[model samples]
Target chain A: MFDFDATMPLMAVQFLLLTAILNAVFYKPLTKALDERDAYIRNNQATAKESLAKAESLVKEYEAQIAAARKESQSIVEKAQAEAREITAQKTAEAQKQVQTQKEQAAQEIQQQKETALATLEQQVDSLSRQILEKILGPELVK
Target chain B: MEILGSLTILNTFTLAELEVGEHFLWKIGNYTVHGQVFIVSWIVIGVLLIASLAATRNIQTVPGEIQNFMEYALEFIRDLTKNQLGEKEYRPWVPFVGTLFLFIFVSNWGGALIPWKLIQLPSGELAAPTNDINTTVALALLTSLAYFYAGFKKKGLGYFKKYIEPTPILLPIAILEDFTKPLSLSFRLFGNILADELVVAVLVLLVPLFVPLPVMALGLFTSAIQALVFATLAGAYIHEALEGHGEE
Candidate 1:
């Protein structure tokens, strides 16, 4: 059997060397990569959450705009209908005024014609009487 | 025939004394290497790597038996590391810590289970490398180096600052403590496994009855505990490296 006293230091040195080499080559890079990967994932998750929130707010804004537009359009339609009814009422009143004026003129014209006709008839009757007296007197005087 | 049979049983339980470098047949110039241990360690590591790879090869949602068992193991180690080191820093160390725990655990158990004598390689005997102080020390050194490097890299000159921090009154003791950390880490594993192996060998020779069974069970328990201790300390070291002199 070999003596333990002789080999102890050699063993220690070898172990120390092995650990140093291994840590440099293997351990450090692996850990750094892992850390980077974790950071990337965290960043991605944060971005996704932000986008999702933005999209949700955008949807709400669109819905609000649509609602406001619908309300405005409904009010516009109501105003137009009121204006049309007012115009129709104004035209009907004007037409009624014209008919009243026409009716009064026609009545006046009829009354005037009747009066003229009466006067003419009286004149004609007077003429016929005169003619009849002349004819009777002339025959008597000549006899 | 009974006598021969008893001799065979005696042989079966015998522990062979093998030299570290005796099995090495290759001589490159003046140097002789323990090709057996190298080959054995290689085999242990390779087999583990290959088996685990195979287990994970085509991962199934509703896994096959092997995949289920392996995934369970991997997840278990992952949880342990996560608990010890916290999730953020623990991810990178998972494969290393996982492999270390598994390799050690498998090797320790392999030493107990695989009858090296039966294989009869040209080598005197073969066992799990972790059973040896050299291999365990290597493992400990690797862990020490890991945390030390982590501390240095994470804090630079501040790594030394930690040795003297809180108060100058504590500096010398802290330095000594830092020096002893790896020693403790290495010996803790080596001492436990060596003792367990020795006890099993002794018990098999002395009392071949129900005694060795309990001892073997204890050995298994110790093996697992040792692996856990090594892994936990390694995790704590990494935590200390990253955290520095902060309050827990």
Candidate 2:
């Protein structure tokens, strides 16, 4: 079995041929498919990450807007409430002032009417007393 | 007389007979070729081709069964080549290393799995191509040529500078190493495969029943390991050739 012959070179050539054939048929296409799939997965992952970041930013922006709007609404409500309280206070003070003037005027008018009635009663009492005296005492003696 | 009579009976009865060193010769032009080796080598080639074709037929991103298996094999080869040849230079060498691994692996397994004895040959019986010294020598020689080519291509004439590295006295030893590399590579493979076949054959001959099964199983295991060892060593040789010897 120690024989050496042309089979060595021929087998080498056969193996080389196999290598070439396998390179063309097996290695090239399979590696290309593998590379393409790798690139596809990487591309999808990158885009997914980008979209997630975008969604997160949008969420933050909306939250900020919501917070600002809430603050603005609260301020507006407070301002309206303060304006209502101020207006109520002003209206109450003005009504009280008007009532005070009207009360003073009525009291003054009643006092003046009472003084006139007392003066008239006093004049009537004097006239009645004078007439009673003229009737009781004789008119010939008084003349 | 009794022993002689038993020997004759054993010879005539074909009780686990082992044949060795026989070849079916085929003449082509002026050179004689081993027809049995070619026959089995062609079968190995055909199997590889059909499997490759089936794997690449559809070429889907989501691979089917055959495609997945082929891809896994390719990835395995890629990793092996990359580990030996490094990341940068490994890509171009993948096909060569991959072919070596696939061819040897399938040939070995095929030899063990196929019932070659059933088909009677005119001269020698069919067996694994690697079991023949000629085939292993051819493969080892190819590895030698590949590494030399890789060295020459990468570093040009400077590849010869490795012979005299550290000291000029090492030149003869380095040159001797070149010859020994192929010798060892070829003999290791040839001896392992031949011994495995012989052990199984002898076991079967001695005990013609269930005793050879475990040895045959071990033979299969060794066959696969041999294929891997051959490919890994070949890749390592190429890598060594490509690497600069601290002179860079």
DockQ score for model 1, please?
0.07
TM-scores of the candidates, chain A only? 0.65, 0.83
The total of clashing pairs for model 2 equals 0
Docking class of 1: incorrect
Across B1-248, the per-residue lDDT of candidate 2 in tens digits comes to: 24433543575434344566878989999998899999999999999999999999899989999999999999999999999999899999999999999999999999888978788888887999998999999999999999999999998999999888778898999899899999999999999988898787777656777998999999999999999999999999999899956653
State fnat for each of the candidate structures.
Answer: 0.13, 0.84
Per-residue CA lDDT of model 1 for A35-70, tens digit only, reads: 455687899999999999999999999999999999
Error of 2 at A114 (Å): 3.6
Task: Tell me the whole-model lDDT of each prediction, alpha carbons only.
Answer: 0.67, 0.90
The sequence of per-residue lDDT tens digits that candidate 1 reaches over residues B1-248 is: 24433544666555433333335344556554444445566666556656555665555445677656666676677787898789788877776676567767877777767666566667435766565666677777677777887788777977888766678788889878777887787778777876776676556656656788888788888888888888888888878877777555
Worst 10 residues of 1 chain B by lDDT: B16-25
lDDT (10s digit) by residue, model 2, range A1-143: 77888999999999999999999999999999899999999999999999999999999999999999999999999999999999999999999999999999999999999999999999999987777777888566544
Collision pairs in model 2: none
**DockQ winner:** 2
Clashing residue pairs, candidate 1? A15-B141, A15-B142, A15-B145, A16-B145, A17-B145, A19-B145, A19-B146
